[model samples]
Target: MFFNHWYKLVGMEALNLLESFIQSAETGSFSAAARRLGLTPAAVSKNVARLERHLGLRLFHRSTRRLTLTTGGEQFFTQVSDPYSALRDAFAGAAQDAGKPAGVLKVSMALAFGREYLVPLLGEFLALYPGIVPDWHFENRPTDLIRDGFDAAIGGGIELTEGVVARELAHTHVVAVASPAYMKGRPLPRHPSDLAAFDGIVRRSGATGRLRAWTLRNQVGEQAAAGHRARLIFDDPEAMAHAAMHGLGIALLPMPHAAPRLESGALMRLLPGWYADNGPISLYYPSRTLLPPRTRVFVEFVVDAFRTKGLARRFDGR
Candidate 1:
């Protein structure tokens, strides 16, 4: 408020660009400021450059190790810092008070599971919060949540980096399933090793390109190798699931993709007692004490929808 009483602010860019200047001024390093801003060092440098161009003053002395504010930079920072913070706080307070999340929500999701299950929930999600605009990407691959600039991601076995957190949406359990037509003449496997006697619709690893073998685990904590002979092979689970449903052979498929078919009688679980527990499909986001309201509400909405819609249990491979 002191600065408010003393100074008239510049253009619109100043408000958005000032924070970058202030962060770099305080940290003395673009790398440090970038980390705080969840951006690349070059981006923070560019932001400060834009601010400098707007103000027609060189704000920082370029150095090999750290930045030092110019005399003019020092004066400007001192004048604007408190008012900038006050302006930020005012926006923050109003946003919290409104409790109406409105933003372009960016998200990454697994293709098969997202299509089979989550896509249906979009209408309801939008109906409840009409202001939110979802920009969704569906693909079968890993994403760097921060570098990729996604607000959140729905996935399984995503490597969590520092300053990121996960909330499990469902167990990413893989179960062996076969079309009923394929299983009609074949005897149901009595044990894990018995699967080897049957034809296998296996998955070739997308990351490694090697065949994915099943190491089955039972409820009693017993473990055994599946070693089913490969009758058909694919790198994508959706394709492998399609092959299995068409009676190609048994496939080791994650429950999210397999559950729909199993329920519809298009596919049936094989060796019911055994499954591979592949970590969990989770809602992942960058960890911040004060998460952006849009992202926060989205996380809450998905978790609540999963619980109420019985998707949690369905996707658990029970």
Candidate 2:
């Protein structure tokens, strides 16, 4: 009986050790894992060391800057990570019941797109799912969803990482736009080559910190009109659109942002046939067999909204 009791205690200790080791491995530092666990860095290191000794294998190669997993550790982590995540989800699921999707739904979104499309839909979404609290971040730049603890993110050109999945919400296309007031006196550009003579309001990429090129494509071929006279440069697409609206210059703007103004006769398409395909805007979240109720509901809501409102087709500029 005493032997069996001792073995059970050792088994429990092993589980704790493995948990600490996994936390350290995932966060890339004992200090980070310690912060998550509300423990000291030394305690986290001790736990990992105990786990390594118990397994009779070196799990990580410790360096001054970072801790990297050994081959055995990598194998172990791959085997356990999913199951561990599922276990956590299972616990979370138990706390909430069916028909009541309650919790904080943390989301990241692009500023202009979210403001134009998503923000308006929040009232209806909140009404439908009263249990859910929407906590959203709207910015020009992409966010690290996992590290930053986002439930989901909506934007185009998000970098896919391990444990992440994306669902296409809409296709995005860009077109050159200018206010009628701006184009009144200027010579109308019948061809791509004529753009060189006109002033351009350009946008710099938030991710790369470089001025974006105006690459337009049609039956003739894809031509990047890089030699336009840049009268103004801005980082945000909305800012560029506003500048173009006030007759600043022709701006290569996303179709979604330009559509309203185009409909209102506030902006005119510079070249009807030529456009830049920016690829699909997607809703990205961590892949899991069982997603959180709040996240699942929000995803469903957004997808349905896009389909019902014809947003996908509109974004495609069809």
Candidate 3:
């Protein structure tokens, strides 16, 4: 029994055991490591305990508040971390090289933006790569890429975490828009300051939980507050757009959400010369060097599609 256990702790069988240890050591918590590995904390703790028994070395000094590394753990981590990462990357690269893009490609997206824009391209994507399956989660808020176990995410205003990177899909901007009916009798704003006269359908910030304010700028280096007197406020931009389309009030909206409505004449752009820089809409994923074939292809496909469709120019508030 002892010989069997000792032999199992070496070579090929050790890879799975080391994965739990490396992740736990790096994160300094079993729960955080569990999230990254898609396992429960108890499972991770057990794996570490099992490894310690096999090695006859205590790896961590555990407490309710924290898991601190023992001397043995620190030495082991320093010796194995780099080589383990390299081994994992090599295995991933080999698997990617062995075949075409295949298996589930999980992605997180912003709710309305994905449905309105990206959903239209799904048929083409799946048809081209039949082996790949898409699992998408659409939500309005920013997500932690590593903690959430997402393969990739599409949205704006994302803060990058360590071991994650983003590619700029488009430069995003916000514009003021209202239905034509709402603007018809009302005097059209000649300047940003003139917006104070109109009723505003404003968006509340999810992070701050307060009404968002806009500072609009023009080409000649002039800036002014939108000065919209709030009539209806919503937590979601989609809701604000919906209210605007029904002529509830003028709304400050990102170009992606406003573009379709503007083209269809359901909404009219207010103050064409003035807009706010909202930052880049990016494709966020775990390490570029470690990307799977499915993720790499999807990223390329989206980037190419945006270029082909002239979405970058359309999204710009020019």
Candidate 4:
């Protein structure tokens, strides 16, 4: 009875600071955690210190150059993050039973995919599960689920990382698309080599803005040459699609993102014979022993939604 009552009266500040401390530990920088929360470095430091004092244990060994979690800090953070996350999920489930999903479900999603595909689906999901609220972080940059506290993310080319669990929610194909105006009687590329002549929209490297190699695969599964370069470049896929739509150049984009334009004949698939890794899009979360019922329900909802929609279809079939 005392335990039940105590859980109910737990203050938000303690939990918020705990979450902040976890982020600071993961990123190894108070300033980074501050930036994420829109707080100053001093504020983040103070909050963590407060939480540490409350627990009567030093959570981090701070220095001017680096912040490392102390042995106790490491154990405390690791042990607490799961229950804290679960507590939040449980509260949300209770709210849902009364007719709403009431917690912040942090999610990271690709810019283009989020905008063109996921955005449309949210309204329907909210209508069905009004208690759940999503705090969506849209970016072209790759997300680190552990460091970032995201409940789930939808991304292409996901490499299975340690301490993370992923479901292959869907698979999709990449298409080389260009605007009709961009084509303007220009000779079409017959092969990947001919792509050299055309301007290309590209994904930027994580460390630097340098263009990344686009890998293409053929029907026989022979990997195409790995180093196709781009002339024009963009970091965000949506920007690349927009640029391609405005007659800037060719783009290898996810089929769903390019669907409306292609269907309207505003953009056309170039070199249909060639194929590339449409990388399996996945829903990833922290590999935990106990996933809360709310998260389980939402994950199932999302996976079912994608599967039901036939999300992996390629352009050739259309």
lDDT by residue (1-318, candidate 1, tens digit) is 224423334655566578788878877888877755667899889988977765678899989998999998898888888777677545543553246877677889988788878789999988877878898889888987765557799988899997689998877688888999999988998887888888888889888889988788988899998876988888888898899888888888888888889999999998886888777778999886667777888999999988889998886754
lDDT of each: 0.81, 0.80, 0.85, 0.73
Model 2: how far is 233 from its true place, Å? 1.8
The candidate, 1 or 4, that scores higher on lDDT is 1
The lDDT leader among the candidates is: 3
Worst 10 residues of 3 by lDDT: 89-98
Query: TM-scores of the models, in the given order?
Result: 0.76, 0.76, 0.86, 0.74
Per-residue lDDT tens digits for candidate 2, residues 1-318, read 222222433654755676677788888888877755657889999998876666667889999888999998897788767666776577547545356788778899988888999999999998988878888888877677765557899998889988799999988888878999999977788766677777889888877888888667775675655346789989888888899999988888888889888989999988777778878989999888889888888899999999999888776642
- Provide the lDDT at 83 for model 4: 74
Q: Count the backbone clashes (under 3 Å) in each candidate.
A: 0, 0, 0, 3
lDDT of 3 by residue, 143-220 (tens): 888766678999988899898899898998899999999988788998888887898898888899999999999999
- Cα lDDT of model 2 overall? 0.80
Best by TM-score: 3
The regions of model 1 sitting more than 4 angstroms off are: 1-11, 15-49, 54-99
Cα lDDT, model 1, residue 172? 67
